[model samples]
Target: MVKRTAEQRVLLDQIKQIADGLGQTLAPFCEVVVHDLLEPEQSILAIHNNLSGRAVGDPTTELGQARITDPDYPQVLANYANQFADGRQAKSTSIGIKDASGNYIAALCMNVDLTLFRSLQMAMGQFVQTATDGPKETLDPAGTDALRDRIDAFAARLATTPRALKTEERRALLGELKASGLLDVRRAMETVAAHLGVSRAAVYSYVR
Candidate 1:
């Protein structure tokens, strides 16, 4: 066990405060820790959010040891892959803090559990999943008798007969037909007027 100087102790305390704030802000899913590099055997000075079930006075992790033992270890390791003891995936960021003498004195670390995110991803995938082998039919208006079928289907969806459809409903249906290029078909207006029990002139006004 190494002895911590007064300056290092103060620095660790301040870092602990930051870790606590970050832990609360990132709540429930993230664990924040402050490691006292001066004492590798009891490196963990504080832990917040507690996702990994680790505690204060825990020994330094392998990465912490690297920072302690190596003079050239990377100062910031961001978003690196990690895992919890129970096999939950984690994303971690470790930042090594150096004292005025250029010696690594502490480390501030954050571990984010990916379980919730991964579960949500899977749920969304299942939600959007569609059956692969059902009703390979097309609503393409250009198919034989398809335009009239589409109008009838639209009225059926509204729980009414085409000839009994309200004025707004007819106008909306004509808009749908116009949008599908079905109105471009020969005698399309005549077909629509006949189906809705209206004259071609009324169909033209609806199309407008």
Candidate 2:
């Protein structure tokens, strides 16, 4: 192992401290990790929240290797999507740390589990749906088949399949649903997400 200078150690320690604080601040959903670039075989120096099922002393990631091999690699890569071994989706950001000699020494990564947030969103949407009185002849919100039919009809109007609709078309469909007050129905986003073959987060992105 190459011996790290005192200055290098101090820099790494500072970075670790920042990682620790971030882990605490974004607890339960986010995982913060610090990787030691010098030790690729056991690169993880510290980890928090433990979302990805990776522990300290785990092997380095492909991004870590890229930083070592490519001097032109960006110092920060933000808000990219990732997935865990258990199939949970995450929105991740990574920051590469460099020593005074411009060599990559450490990396700070934050991974936020979108699966949990999506579930919470669905629950909240269900809970907050406005109640109405009177006999309405709309599609049953609880029936997945009904929801799928609505999605298919909307997609048909655009001359595309629900799974192949462009982003703008998806947003338009969502807008139409909202205008029709379908979004106010319980679990509507969940059904739409399923019909579109995407996570609820993707559905929410269009709404947002």
Candidate 1 backbone overlaps, count: 0
lDDT of 1 by residue, 60-160 (tens): 99998998888589999999999999999999999999887788999999999999999999999999998898778766344437778999999999999
In candidate 1, residue 48 scores what lDDT? 92
Instruction: List the global CA lDDT of all models.
Output: 0.90, 0.89
Q: Which number leads on lDDT?
A: 1
Model 2: per-residue lDDT, tens digit, 1-208?
8699998899889999999999999998899999998888899999999988888889899999999888668999999999999998999999999888888988999999999799999999999887688577766566556667778999998888999988999999899888877787788898899889989999999998
lDDT of 1 at 69: 85
Q: For this target, which candidate reaches the highest TM-score against the unseen true structure?
A: 2
* Model 1 / residue 192 / CA error / Å: 33
Q: What range of 10 consecutive residues in model 1 has the weakest lDDT sum? A: 137-146
